[model samples]
Target chain A: MRWRVIGLETHDAYINMALDEAISEGIRTGSSPPTIRFYNWEPGAVSIGYFQGIRDEVNLEVCRELGVDCIRRWTGGGAVYHDSGGELTYSVIAPAGVFPKNIIESYRLICGWIIRGLEILGIEAEFRPVNDILVKDKKISGSAQTRRGGILLQHGTLLYGLDLKTMFSVLNVSRQKITDKMIKSAEERVTCVLMHREAGREEVYEALLKAFTEDKDYGFGAWNRDELVRARELAEKKYKSEEWTFLR
Target chain B: MITHSSRKVKEGKIVKVEVDCEDVIKKLRITGDFFLHPEDVLDDIEKTMVGLKKDVSFETLVIKINDIVKNNDARMIGISPESIAEVLREALK
Candidate 1:
């Protein structure tokens, strides 16, 4: 099956999420092809799982001070701090039938591409079940998946660099002191690509693009006019609204 | 009053439950990093919890949730009915 491969692009948090939802709608209606895309958040952002209580997971004061966007995802997962220069995000949307029926099996299949990309960079990584990619037992990437109306949407983040201070400040880690011990403990569990190699973000993106498209029928593509319009509307009406952001 | 409890399940996800109850459960909210396909199944599960006795037995909660899962053909990863039941039990305490 032919897939649309969108190269790494940058957008604010709302528009980024809106585009994914829009594409999913398009795919369900047979207007869009199966797609795999890479992107970066601008001004950075903090995203919480659909079921999470945002006030419990995000430090809104810190986010406002730093001008970071905080939004609740349509998918369930832990809160994530997406740093513009420190992370790379990818999404795959296709009919559920194209992938394994078992959820973990599907994660392994999609996460395998990330593992392959890490290998290409000479960085060995493994897929930790339920959506995580780890290098030497330290997490380097995390993903979340949600299936709606027969189209399965899986999106995740690949850390390229570390910014523990900012990440912690924005992620409601206020109950604990932000000290050396905290950073040390976090560094032990979380990691990024730069920690393993010196590849620039552009090089990493190319490697990931190659790994994701390898042996698959896909081509570089762009969003259609209708998708852009829909995304803009969703961004303004849904993602940017208080009702959705504050939803638990 | 609202009672809350949270735990990191051995299955590898954080499960946090907040329940509003006096005698019968008036409200229940389950939040976590766990995965649930066709995610709205969670809403259904929470809805089922409403009107249940606050002192609902662990086994009863499991049966209630499992029935909903089977009915909806829902799939959960990094979490299970037993784990959610355990959290709900703790919140009741």
Candidate 2:
């Protein structure tokens, strides 16, 4: 089967997420081929899982003060602080029949591509069960998936850099004081490509693309007019609506 | 009246369950960041909980929860039926 690879582009949180749903719907109905998209967030954002309460998961006051966008994802998992220029996000939308039917097994199968991508960058990474990729005992990536109709959409982040202080500030951390030890522990837990070596953005992007396309039949593709229209409509009607973001 | 409680499980997942009962459970709503297979299984589990006796024992609740999850082939990542039952037990108090 031939896969469609949509190259990297940066957009606001609403549009990027809207496109994922719209494209997945196209794949579901056979209007478009299964696709893999690479993208980035422009002004930074915080995306919480589908069922998570934004108030409970995020420091909304800080987010507002800093002009960071906050939204809810269509998939289930923990909250994530997606910093602009700090992360590379990828989405894979395919027919459910193309992957394992079991939830856990499918997560392992899809996350393997992420590990392979890290390997292409000369980084050794391992898949930690249930949707995390670890490099030397520290998390380098996390993914989440959701299945609807006949399509499966999985999207996640691969850190190129991380602003630990900014991230902890936006995310809810019950501790009154974030001690030096706390920061040290966080650094020990999360890692980014920048911490390993100096690498250009394009180089990292190419390595990821190579890892994703290895041993697979794929070619560059663009969203059709119909897909773009649907995405815009969904963005306005669903994703951008306050009711949807705070529905939980 | 409905009673609700939430717990932050060890895995950083939240398990929030709400129960409405007078003598029997009139409603149940389960909401959280936990992943459940097939996605809609939460609705099924909620439906199953409703109409159950309010005084249902912890052991019985656990067995019922396990049966529901197993029968649906539902896998709860970062959250477990035991953790859910713990919340329910606390709400009952």
Whole-model lDDT values for every prediction: 0.90, 0.84
lDDT string, candidate 1, A200-226, tens digits: 999899889999999999988999998
User: Where does model 2 exceed 4 Å of error?
Assistant: A174-184, B1-14, B17-29, B44-55, B63-73
Model 1 misplaced regions, further than 4 Å: A173-184
Model 1 TM: 0.96
Q: On residues A50-115, what C-alpha lDDT tens digit does candidate 2 reach at each position?
A: 867788779999999998999888888878899999999999999989899887788898888878
Under CAPRI classification, how is model 1 graded? medium
What are the clash counts of all predictions, listed in order? 0, 0
- For this target, which candidate reaches the highest TM-score against the unseen true structure? 1
Chain A TM-score relative to the true structure, per candidate? 0.95, 0.94
